[model samples]
Target chain A: MLNQLARDVKASMSIYDAGDDKVYGLLAEFAHPGELLHAAEAVREAGFRHFDTHSPFPIHGMDKAMGLGNSIVGWITLGGGITGLSLATLMQWWMGAVDYPINISGKPFFAVEPSIPIMFELTVLLASLATAAGMFALNGLPRPYNPLFYSKNFARVTDDAFFLHIAASDTKFDRDATAQMLEKLGASNVETIHDHGVEDQD
Target chain B: MSTASTDKTLAHLADFHDEAPLVKGNLTFHDITEIVSSHTEKKTPFAWYGAFSLALAGLMLLVGMIAYLFWNGTGVWGLNNPVGWGYAIVNFVFWVGIGHAGTLISAILFLFRQQWRTAINRSAEAMTIFAVICALVFPTIHVGRVWAIYWTLPLPNQMNMWPQFKSPLLWDVFAVSTYFTVSLVFWYIGLVPDLASMRDRAKGKLRKLVLGVASMGWTGANRHWRNYEKAYLLLAALATPLVLSVHSVVSFDFAVSIVPGWHTTIFPPYFVAGAIFSGFAMVVTLLVIARKIYGVENIITVDHLEKMNIIILLTGTMVGFAYITEFFIAWYSGVQYEQYAFVNRMFGPYAWAYWTMMSCNLFFPQFFWFKKLRRNITFMFIISIFVNIGMWFERFVITVTSLHRDYLPSSWDYYTPTAVDVLTFVGTFGLFFTLFLLFLRFMPMVAVAEVKGIMPEADPHFYDHEGDGHHAEHAVEPSTQQ
Candidate 1:
């Protein structure tokens, strides 16, 4: 019974086996930002869409090299801010003017001057939340597992290393040809990552 | 050039020549990771234990005092009719003021592209959260019946009553809560990259698991970074206005009032300046100790301290000017109550507090005008403490003295904080310190990724052979492959 349970847990964990033939992607390591940029541009010009670079920090021109447009987070923040302003203003006006009106100083029940502070505060509050949420949603984050995490070389991306990964799922992906291309582009180390889906076959 | 002009030009060049490296030591990527992570991964130091114990004791005292006050009532404090807004309000203002510097360093300075902020922004942002926590405590308890605190929010109820949207007190609720939420988000987003770094390096399985979850699977992917940088920039932009608005609204808690001392147009800008002054002082005080304890002096160098001191001097001068202008306006306007309020602040029962405020906020920081004193860690630390004390008194004098002898002389009574009041204030420091100590124990005090970004080695130009056309052509050959 214990042996069965252990086998079940191992199967659920989807541990990658060394002999697995299924390729998740090819990861190419670069020594510096310039090399990574040049490699990214080369990949872009070659018509690859499912490729990405990883570095300890954001490189200045890497976005342009990768052919990425400006992020949509700004638009989302603006939408959220407008929603908050409208909500706050309407809420205040309803409560003080229409709902349960009280004459404190004989001032109008709903005045724009009095409502400005709350409106301003709520706008900023919503805009900030939207920015964080939009960024995470756009980036497809909180995914605790990825095939790239299996590569030992990829670990240094957060510290000292830079990397570019070409997904096997890409229509034009050819494992041997991509590796050769990356090698020519001065990648120090190139490794093939096996997908989690391969574990089912094993 | 003439000889005299050449001499002046030389001096000008000398000013630019004295530029110091923000991060000292020939640090590599591995070295930065090791230096920062060691503080969290290694066993807690003896000094940390000692300070944490003291802070814990203070936190316990704070809890006890709050418990006692709750059991007894507002009478436990020295609050009476005239002096109703006593130590609690004073402490709230003081802590809120101290919270501003973090936002200034992280958001404002970041917006301006100040690279030096990388060394201190993480801890400063943490301080912002903790200080806001400390500040929020006073108003909650000051409400006396904490159970009814929900009424402060604009929630639907059977009573059909809503918070007065026009009241500055209500504005404070929106302002402070918004400030806390925004600061927390900003701080966390900044932490995501560092947390991933920690997760990768963490040894124990439990540590790795916790950090991994906290990091949200950040892989430093370029696509992720593209969005991340955009969000960070927008948050910084959002936070800049939010920071200014928060203190301005806090100032509205006084400025909008009809009270003689509190009613003034200058309160907004003056409060903001004073907030930065006191906040920087608090940062300096905490950092001086932190650097020594953590052995991070190379990163948070004397140059960082000098820069912070210069800010203190500038803001301190602005605050001093505000004081003079307040008095001048009172006299020139010839408003009897306004003039009386200014005179009473200077020469009344709270004259000692007023003088303390002046000497600490204005006179003490003037010592920083001397380059030697600004660079001396010991002197900077002492001056920072003085500034903290002065800021507290400034709030006390502003809140209490103005109300103690208002329009009606019949209700005049001197305010004195009881044991509960005094202990609660001290306990807040304990509360702040305890949270800060735990943060130091676990979280990354320095922003590793940000600091790495500013390093010369991170620059693409650092290793590029721009002058050698042959090598440049050779470098591009690999990319020419089909």
Candidate 2:
């Protein structure tokens, strides 16, 4: 009963129904990465706060075109690296000097010279872990479902296609207007994506 | 080759400005996806089963031998008085050395902006992970009391004992584990997008479901790719230093000792160069077979193999120079023990192994100076095998010859590896091949997204023939400016 309840809660958290009055977004299919990049720039210029571009591979200048700033993953990695350094140092000093000290060939109990390798290793390890975890967290990944998956044409996003999506929740979003705007920006196959499928919090 | 270059045509050929295509055959994005994914999507072939069965048998042998050692103790091997470190340590170093090329290609070359690395880096990184696994096994089982291996770690045990931080072995424990973890993370980060591509192409419900979760619903969003690319760059930077240091610490295992043969300041750089040398050779060995079997010749082209050969030539010479420098230093130091160690290696019971190392590592790679031979698949394969054999013997000569005739003639004894030692060594190859075979069958052996990213059409400017003024500015990646 508890397992079933947990599953129900997760399902409720994820699913979004596009009833007669609701939609997920306006999805526009662009011909190529160059067009999609320009479309993203145009969408941002039109004051749409919630818009995204999708392509098979990362298009150069897309972040700038979309008015996005530098990624914060580097800062997260730095934080993780500092934590690892502190923990590794403390672990070694306490274990060697404070907790259970043993004399080894009359060498110092907690010398930084000897501890550098482990300290370096731990720092890199933690920093790398934080980079990966921060990337996944920032992207809101492991989301097995998305309303965008409902479109059969959208399957090609991982192939050769380029796409731009403006969510219905955006204050600037009018379904027909967004479609017309995307088409004006050189997009084809402009369509409204309904939210009957599972969706996550943007 | 020089004879073919006529004076009139030489200038024209040299002035040719067009770059060689990174991908051959003019394959579309869908074609690359299909070519890589078909191995996973299609039915299992009989040959794969046959090879897998052989590998499994070898894995079983490795397990059985290890269990036998656990039951029978270290005495089962021909480890005598001074030669306590035998095949186990030799194999440990050899396999660890073989694992270096992947990170060198993926992390180091990526940082250097070598575009060709994209094609081979995925499979090479996979090799690194598997080779490290094989390398880790030797040291784990080599510890006589295997159950008490936890003592090597820094857990709060009741005994109140802590590992010696100053010891190179403890440093090794930290280094190899960290290397493995970081490599795994780096490899996975690269795999995510490719896995998402696979998830989209997946047909069966189970395969799709598994790949979907594995991919973490990666939709290749611009915002996500921004962070994703930054994370990749950071990881690559971290991995570069980590790879260099891992082998340096491994070399510290010997160099820290006062033993005449093992003690030297040159060991760190020498060992690192040798690691890359052997690692690239191993990559060449596997890729030569894999590209043919998987029909990915265009992806991992002849040019890729030739570049690897040049690296082999470069590092092979570096290793040879190190060897000669060791001899010069040994004699010049005027230490009789160090001098004797060098002399014994050349004119001792294991002189055969020493000569084999010299010929395989130094003599054969010289053939790569000829462009024709370097590009010849048959010649490269044979030389790669020679380097692999030579590198294993190099470790053997270092470990065994150094010990078989130490300072005291009274206690010195010949170190002959018993059947158990030989079989256990052979078993690691089985373990490596088995994991590698599974990876080839299940995963995208060539990095699909990365290869696509490098294609001419992938450029946003590729389709901009209208002489658009803004494209030139957009081509300057803001990330690069940062």
Candidate 3:
């Protein structure tokens, strides 16, 4: 539940400086997934480590391009499903067998046939909640604002543009070298965004 | 062809992105403004909405009829001592039957990986909710002492009157509420991404706030996408069984009893198939009109309709098979009461209803075997309506005819639907259309983001310039769990 802006607040401002001051880097603008992969390589080759590529849709190979690995969504879903199953089993057993005993047509109070509906409902209910909660947790959702919003151009991201931002925090981040790499990879437009610091934030 | 299909699909994906001069692909801020402002809100063509309004008005009339029936007692309907259920149960079965296709389309199609369903799933789901609402009306109203309806629920009231847990009617309460809630959640979850798509594109503050909260702070992160997909898969899995259980329990209401006509073993699957048959027929009816009205020809193509009509035929044949089986089994069992009931159906007092049910459900769907009629919008629409009529007749044949001529001839009496019965039936149609039409107006009827995601052209690889790099990374072996 970390505020996206709060998490983003800790991010060091990324500034890629081109050697000749043309500063064309900002690889996020690449339209093709393939271009993004090459751009990642170029960043690696140029010895910059803190860049992220973003697009409106997940590209087939974008994870590998960004060197990302397995998501925790599956584990979260499994944990949720287990919790839901146990809770349901407990609720049904307590209500039907222990708390109050009621019989219909000589059937057992906790007849599995009748309780199947409840058990299934609980399983689904629990699994769905877990998925939602897990997703929010993993995605760091409920983030109110982000510094990325300061660059209005970033909004086009919701549209057609793809982009990459090389942060200054990367071990090999040479601003000039990174910008030069982006310029070579056919970026449509690139801007070096500045941070006004935490004091400027209201 | 495989490579070409892949390339073609991949290429078509990006057709909606926001890049070109007038906003490159998909709905840009401008496209959303235009669709919402110009078309969606543009008074909905009085002729079209006027027609919808007429249907809605008729639905109100049905409600009025129900009110009159409830107030005046079950006597307002044509029910006598033997015939307790008439049009109410018929309409109940009809509406509930129609509700099945929605869940089938959404949950089953999702599980089966049928991408073609996205165009109509939202509408189908909404139909499921409204139909269940209509279905709930009957059993509650069918109990003549309408005021004491709450007696079915167990509570800490003054009277210690326990709801008959043994009764199938009580089971219906649980089954229906669960189906409704789970279906609604499944539908809303499906809509979340599209809602986010809508929110991000909205121009005004009113639009922004409304769409924003509904979108639930969706940023479409890869993780969110991953979990969203998983939840959808799980819901689909849950719903697959739910689709079977809801109707099967409803069938148990009749099948558990030893009533001559109603006690057949085939009723469960027969009724289930018939329910799905009628439900799919209704889906076809709605989608045919909706696609034209919404101008989503590409999304809900003729192919989708053709496939649906094919299901109608398949289920209809199954239903027809059940009808024949019922007669054969009744005769073969040689139980005199069962034998008499089967003979009585064809030659009995309400043979018109029996034959009508046969022709409507069995005969009408036969024409769909022709590729032309299945794809032909007008023919398909007319046939869909016929299937609806046929399914209603099927229920009538099952309920009224069976009751009018029971084991003992002296106790037998004919069932007739009075004015209130007829009006209430018409009213249910009104209720269904009023809600369906409104959903069409405000909601993103087609899941725009999902459709966008599936398009092959949407992927950046489709562009002439970027292939080699992405191919290398995608070469990372998939998880070897398989």
Candidate 4:
């Protein structure tokens, strides 16, 4: 009974199995950004949650069409900026006032007036770094392995082509039904893509 | 899709505004990708090789001169009693000023939603990073002891000596270093999507591997782009004030001091204006050559150059006004030392330098006010070169003139740069150009994803709402239609 349960869990978690030549998902190519956007809205309305649209550039209003909300990157950057400000202030106060104070023209130690420049610089630097890192982390980037790469036609997604991908892991995914829906929505081509599985990669 | 159909959609969009198209030639996204990527994918051109060789030679000269300077000392340069600061400080300020134009275009103009910046922001940002590197070399070597450079930082030494936080020079270390780091991060973030495009279109394993690593497997997912765009906007917001603060801090290095000509409240704004003026001139100088050689003139159009020239004219006028204001204030203050500094600058040994600065920075840019002159490629290019020369002299005049004639008449002397000083300054050019040439050779000089984003075809409603005669409410504003 335990062995059967283990097998069932493995099957449910396996989105793709290259060893068995298992299908990954349906990859559909659209003619342009407008078609892709509309198709994404249709797929969302059709009850598919595990889908994404791809284009060479960010299409304005794509997030709305895909049912995504405002990104949390701004809050992340603000947190980072506050952290930077606190650290800069503490470091300056500790060093100048507590640790190794110096008397320069009788000016007070650890004054805020003179420390504003460094404080501002650190805030900007940390905020920028946090923004970039938060963006990458939120997107789950550096994920070089994706089933859509198996489609040769998908190469143009970064050039001129637009694509919509519906993962097989979706509970509503019916292979034939998904392909047909994509075709009806004006997709120029729809193909089943697979995960060739992991190998030695750079 | 056919080019005609794309043009038709673009024309429909243009009905909102009478402005010219930002991207010329009615090129498609594929054409843009092909044009930008082929420079990296194909074999290197002879012209590139020639330019690289010359730049490499200059880099070598710079390296050798630094080695010689290290062997000797700061005394090797013409550092006299009063004019202890010479070519080193002048060159540092000059190069740092040149770096400002890049950040201005990439960050400030981005915040303003200037669509034309898409054509030149990538290369301009790259130039900013390289120019900062060159600017840094002088300060590092000028300390006369390269190995002890860590003393400038607030590291915990055995002696427990922390950097004096009150010093403007220390403020400079933090400000410039912070500027360099933030600019680098900003530039790299912009390059990721373009690098991903290069990766997808790549042929070789090594090339693919390198780009794959650099791009972080960017797939242009809407999920990713949503976050990416937000990050880009936030970074632009952060960098705008940071750019302004950087030049202001640099001006503080002089303004906070008790020097007769340097101690003025006007230095910060004046310095910032001059930096932008010189930076725009430098960008114009480089883009004119780069676009012609790479056959990307259609992408980076004459309209872009005309816009940049207008900025140069505006900033040049501001700088000239500051110059006049300085003289007037010196006379009105009735401080004999300050009054003498201005008189000496105009009629002193460095008068030639001051007038050269006036002609290049103040006089030449006035011609750009005329539409024909602004649009004339050869004329603008010449004016850009003159502006570069004039800005350099501006720094020289400010640094040398104030110091040469001290309050004590006996210490007044005419300062001259040795051959070492002159050659070391020239070598910095080599350092700047070598990095720039390598960048042009390997990287996408134009931001491909950004340029595509601005194209008419990238609009979501361009195809869906066509012929309905009712555009979406979120359609690009008429003012930003370009």
Taken over the whole model, the C-alpha lDDT of each candidate is 0.86, 0.86, 0.69, 0.88
- The parts of candidate 4 lying over 4 Å away from their true place are A1-21, A198-202, B1-18, B465-482
Residue A171 lDDT in candidate 2: 74
Tens digits of per-residue lDDT for model 2, B1-482: 12232222223323322346668875777778878888888998899999999999999999999999999999999899899899999999999999999999999999988888999999999999999999999999999999999888998788878888889999999999999999999999999989998888888999989999999888888878998999999999999999999999999999988888999999999999999999999999999999998999989999999999999999999999999999999999999999999999998888899999999999999999999999999999999999999999999999988887778889889888999999999999999999999999999998888988876656665545345724432131211010
Q: After superposition, how far is residue B42 of candidate 2 from its true place, in Å?
A: 0.7
lDDT of candidate 2 vs native?
A: 0.86
Worst 10 residues of 3 chain B by lDDT: B473-482
Clashing residue pairs in candidate 4 are none
Report how far residue B85 has shifted in candidate 2, in Å: 0.5
What's the C-alpha lDDT at position B253 in model 3? 76
Pull out the clashing pairs in model 1. none
TM agreement with the true structure for every prediction: 0.92, 0.92, 0.80, 0.93
Better of 3 and 4 by lDDT: 4
CAPRI quality band, candidate 1: acceptable
In TM-score terms, candidate 4 sits at 0.93
Give the candidate order by descending DockQ. Answer: 4, 2, 1, 3
- lDDT, candidate 4, at B214: 95
